[model samples]
Target: MPEAHIARTGPRILVFSTNPISDPGIDLVGSAHMRYQPGVVTIPVPCSSGIRPSWLLHAIEAGFDGVFIAADGGDCAFVPDCTTRTAKIVDTAQKLLTEHGHDPQRIKMAAICSVCAEPFVNHMEKFSAALEALEV
Candidate 1:
């Protein structure tokens, strides 16, 4: 029996959180990414929107597969426009990546509310699968 091989393509996913990982009540997400730690590296940012263009470019230059910005939505306790701007940059960056002949799928954006962890995990899986398809 031949097992299908999965090529690990795409920049290793970096999940940028607008809130600190140390914050309480962040968990409620059991099966959400708790099963296996794949290529995802989580970095807690002040605000997902605060990520600069240079930083994103630096990440790509550093050999990252891709960067995924997931910001706080619904009730934005910190800044109202933070996640909005993050979404904007994500769109802008994807276009830039496509312009450079790179797979624009390298960048992604998602808004996570209190109960959206499961969906978040789902997106991660889908993104990873899409990356795999791109390799084919």
Candidate 2:
């Protein structure tokens, strides 16, 4: 089988978003005509708390420059402790990144609400900048 190809012109970021919450906010960025880095890609999951640390590491190994977790925070309807659980996932992923000689800063997490189009764009911009700086 041929290897999958992703042509990236700049820092490539993979974002994990909660389907019920942050996914809508990320979608709003496009609907509202807000622009972010072309390399930013998002995959919606049922809940942020369900994300596996191994998946985050796999993204880095698969050529992503960074990974961002758009956590549901206090607004999660699926898990009452979603924020805390997601934070632990970040911590574990960072530790694994460090163990494998990768920069732990490549992972970031933040709360993005359903109506946070502008904020989502802002986060993407900031994350892109941060990833670029890491390469320097």
Separately for all candidates shown, the number of backbone clashes (residues 3 or more apart, or on different chains) is 5, 0
Clashing pairs in 2: none
TM agreement with the true structure for every prediction? 0.73, 0.93
Give the candidate number with the greatest lDDT: 2
lDDT of 1 by residue, 51-108 (tens): 7755665666677777777776545666678667777787777777776777877777
**Which residues of candidate 1, in runs, are more than 4 Å off?**
1-11, 20-33
- Give the lDDT of residue 26 in candidate 1: 28
RMSD of 2: 3.6
- Alpha-carbon shift of residue 48 in model 2 (angstroms): 0.2
- For candidate 2, give the lDDT: 0.93
Ten-residue region with minimum lDDT total, candidate 1: 20-29
Candidate 2 segments exceeding 4 Å error: 1-7
